[model samples]
Target: MEALEARVEALCEQGNALADLEDHAGALGRFEQALALLPEPQDSHPSTLWVCVAIGDMLFLLERYPEAREFLRRAVALPDGLGNPFIHLRLGQCAFELGDKRRAGDELARAFMGAGDEIFDGEDAKYLQFVRSILLPAQDA
Candidate 1:
């Protein structure tokens, strides 16, 4: 079981590396493999939220907006204290792409609110401003 867990972790790392390289198909394959190796949710093991988030991110990059939104929603709905602001940001992006402007705005707002100063720097600040000025107003109007 320990070895299986280690292999799953290694595969997740490989998937992330492939994502960084923009090889979406390869990344998805690795992530799927990792997911398959893990026990069911009720069994004791590492949470699959991170893997789901990674898969959602790859789907977003591939412009599969609906699938991305589904996966990201699951990631965000995971147990409290396990959620990441970055996952919220990705979900916002997916929602925006899917033409769910209201949800997009709400998700982005949550992301901005939850992200610590350490994470929301420079370009992220610019993105937050853009979301607030453009997306939020569009939703309201």
Candidate 2:
């Protein structure tokens, strides 16, 4: 980890702890604080990806789908972001909640393909069901 990464990681750890305790609002605040530490063009920082993901996840938990989508999309632009299943899953969920079924199906499929069904274990069944509705039919064909 880089010098600032250690500091941001510390804050992220605290945010993770708060998130684990279901204090998503507090976690979001901590993540935002950590993100603010980075220089201009935050995407250049390695820590930006996870911080954005954490903030987006918190926003998702809070049912702030639009804000969640914005942050998650930002993460997707960062390093290794596109390959992270959790990011895809949340983006899918946000799209679903936002009534964008096309994007939901596309993103959910990416999540499922990236990490398998286990990623969907703790998530709402409806999400997996929606993904299946799109994927299973293709398999059948």
Candidate 3:
């Protein structure tokens, strides 16, 4: 089990590096491998949260909407995932892509409201902008 844990950690690190390099396909594969090594029904494991989010986001980048929704849903249900505005933001994006307007609105609102006045910096900031542009206008209508 320790050996597997080490392997999972290594794979996650590699996946993150790949993602940083914009090799999303390679990142997805590494994350998938790490996820498989982790326990099943992974909500209890702290390590599973990030991997799930990585896979979910990668799948979204790949335009696999339903799979992205599923993984993001799983990620958000994990203890470490709920407070991550990125998870909510990604889930909203996935919902929007899937044409689930109601969910997209709800999730985007959660993400935006959760962000408060803090200035997001990086990809998250972009996601925040997307939420504001798309969801805030709907609020007026």
Candidate 4:
């Protein structure tokens, strides 16, 4: 178990390095390798949260929204996932791309409430605009 943990950590580091180099596909592969090493129920593994998020984030960067959404959705149900701003932000972006306006709004609002608009900084403006549109309406009403 310790060996596997070390391996996962190494893979995660490599994945992050690749991400920093703007090699999203390479990052995704490394993250996937780390994920595949986890036990049967990957969610039970502590690394699942970050690894899944990394994979989902890389996929999102690669413009694979549907696949990214699937991964982020699974990750959101894992430990410490619900209030994670990054997970919610990516999930929202994926949902928006897939034309799920209601879900996109819900996730984006969670993200905004958790980390504020800065989480949307690296991405496009439309997500923040959409979140405002959704939340502002409720606030006014």
Candidate with maximal lDDT: 2
Which one wins on TM-score? 4
Model 2 per-residue lDDT tens digits across residues 1-141:
387777788889999999999999999999999999888878997788989999999999999999999999999978899878999999999999999999999999999999999999988999999999998875533
- The lDDT per prediction is 0.75, 0.93, 0.82, 0.93
The alpha-carbon lDDT assigned to residue 63 of candidate 1 equals 86
Give one digit per residue, the lDDT tens place, for model 1 in 14-121. Answer: 998998898998998898888788887622344577778888878888888898888888777776423477887887777776778788777776777777434446
Model 4: per-residue lDDT, tens digit, 1-141? 899999999999999999999999999999999999999877888889889899999999999999999899889999899899999999999999999999999999999999998998978999999999888865533
lDDT of 4 at 120: 88
Task: Give stretches of model 4 more than 4 Å off.
Answer: 137-141
lDDT of model 4 at position 82: 89
Q: In model 1, what lDDT does residue 31 have?
A: 89
Q: Comparing candidate 2 with candidate 4, which one achieves the higher lDDT?
A: 2
Per-candidate TM-score against the hidden true structure: 0.80, 0.93, 0.81, 0.94
| Better structure of 1 and 3 per lDDT | 3
lDDT of 4 at 99: 96
Reference-based TM-score, model 2: 0.93
